[model samples]
Target: MVTNLRADAARNRERVLEVARAEVAEGNVSLQLNEIARKAGVGVGTVYRHFPTPRALLEAVVGKELATMVQLTEQASQMQDIRAAMEFLLRRTLDLQLCTSGGLAEVICAIEDADERTTHAKSEMRRLADHLLERARAAGVIRPEITGEDVRNLMAGLERAVELDPDRADVYVSVLIRGLSG
Candidate 1:
């Protein structure tokens, strides 16, 4: 009976997370716990018991994507061609950001007091991104003045542009890459 109850609780938590993810993916950043509970078909107490706060829920939703970003940065750092690696990182990062409805950017770029895991992931990504930038600059593939923060802000701007005009994302990225290469 205890095992069954634990299994049921786990299922409820997963359901709440699923609904919350869907809400964020639909561009709903102001995740209301009560609404998530309603959509999850679970009680408010259950949702609170699982997530405690909206920030907690948002962190959970974006955590995987954050890890993926870090992984992409690490992968880019290992590539033989610095220019190609930088382009690959930019494209993959933008793709991931677009797919997550910009949630990853909101969390990593805007949120300052994220939970420990998220904070650590953000730091790791920044470190790897900085290393990639250094390599690109050393190889004379990109402008020497561009910093990681600049790249982050540029990507955020591109995300907004793509959101406004989805068809031109590739063109926008291509233009960005060309401009960065100088």
Candidate 2:
């Protein structure tokens, strides 16, 4: 591990991660290692060296993308405008779920499970929801009874809307907001 890989080798590793980001969650995260190696202009052995197991590679790829959502959620939580944060989180979550419908259940499940602990991913989601809810409730825009937990569930199923009709994502999102709003 101390030995540094050549410049090309380092770049190839990054390329593999990038390509796998989208492909991994699709269940096709299992894209042929050889093909990735080819795309990365490296030998299959190099890919093996970086990721010895299929599961390890999938975890790495999906983990990185999940971290991006966590970050967005954390930032949204800190925004001064509650409505903006709420809207941003909903839209970004929807975008990710819809675009990755091929394997969304896993991602949603991953987030949901993580929210049970104080992990960075879970904490980000909670923080964002709390900030948004506080603003909405104060504005009397969201139902007083609405809890951050409800938003959690709503976010998880936002992807389900994708399966009904891809073109009606906006409508589904609207419905979600209405149902969640006071």
Candidate 3:
């Protein structure tokens, strides 16, 4: 009976965390405990019992996003064609950033409070990015002199362009991808 109670409690916390992550990633950072509880289908008190405070919940959500990004970068590194993988990473990342609400701000904000796990995740992402650039260069799909920092800056610029002129995001991304190919 005690085990079942513990499991149920854990499940509630997981559900709350999931909803909090989506909400924050969607740029709704002013998350209310009541709303989170309502979304997670748990009691308001249950959320309080799990997170104690909104910051705790937000921190957990940020950690979850960082972990997710690390997994994605790892997956990208394993793709057969580094160029295609890079394109996929850019498109998918931008899509997530532009989905309903901007995720770039969320990512930037979370990075400021990055814990050890988040820091490691970011480092792993950078390592994977470097590997991808090397592979793409070796394959003659990208300029040999191009570095991971260049690609990272390009992505940041692209995100900014999209934020400034959302309707032309597709055009901007296409041009950037073509430029990278050269």
Candidate 4:
């Protein structure tokens, strides 16, 4: 969507995106465009000119991280070693849950009315789930009963738990992975 921009405008847009993403990642659910503009050394009009609404800005923040996760998951799923896939997934899940980006994932997941844009997220998760669950089960690593839905629920739970104690997420992840095995 972002094709071309003046140098100053491009810098301003990048600045807003970075600061807005960081703020939202830090649990600032109500972060506004004006605040982002102020932080970016630009005027509110400039921010609004680029991003129409707060939701749009938040969506951009979420989408940026979502793209990264999609690439990571897709890449990991293709790995020949099942343990590598599982470990990659675990690391990604832990990062998303414990890092500032965790907040954005939680917000996106919590939305009651997920539009067309969000629906694609589910499909991508299913891809990761199928890859990991099948490999884990075939290797007799984890139980066979765990489905893709189960994985999704686990992710949501992990996100919630990590939000409560970001510092303890590593411990929680270790315990959770252990429980996943047979």
- Which one wins on lDDT? 1
Model 1 regions lying over 4 Å from their true place: 1-5
Query: What's the lDDT for candidate 3?
Result: 0.72
Q: Write the per-residue lDDT of candidate 3 for residues 50-94, one digit (tens) a residue.
A: 777675566566654556666777788899977788788778766
For residue 161, model 4's alpha carbon misses the true position, in angstroms, by 3.5
State the lDDT of candidate 1 residue by residue for 14-83, as single tens digits.
8988998899899886789999999999999998987788887888888888899999999999999998
Model 2 lDDT per residue over 1-182, tens place: 21487887778788877766656555374567777777667788988888775545554555545666677777787787776777877888777655554343354344433222224555565666677688789977688898877775676676665666778878888888788774
Clashes of each: 0, 2, 0, 0
Clashes of 2: 2
What TM-score would every model get versus the actual structure? 0.90, 0.62, 0.61, 0.71
lDDT accuracy of residue 66 in candidate 1: 88
- State the C-alpha lDDT per candidate: 0.88, 0.66, 0.72, 0.72
**TM-score computed on alpha carbons, candidate 1:** 0.90
Whole-model alpha-carbon lDDT for candidate 4: 0.72
Clashing pairs in 3: none
Model 4, residue pairs in steric clash: none
Top candidate on TM-score is 1
Cα shift from native, residue 153, model 4 (Å) = 3.8
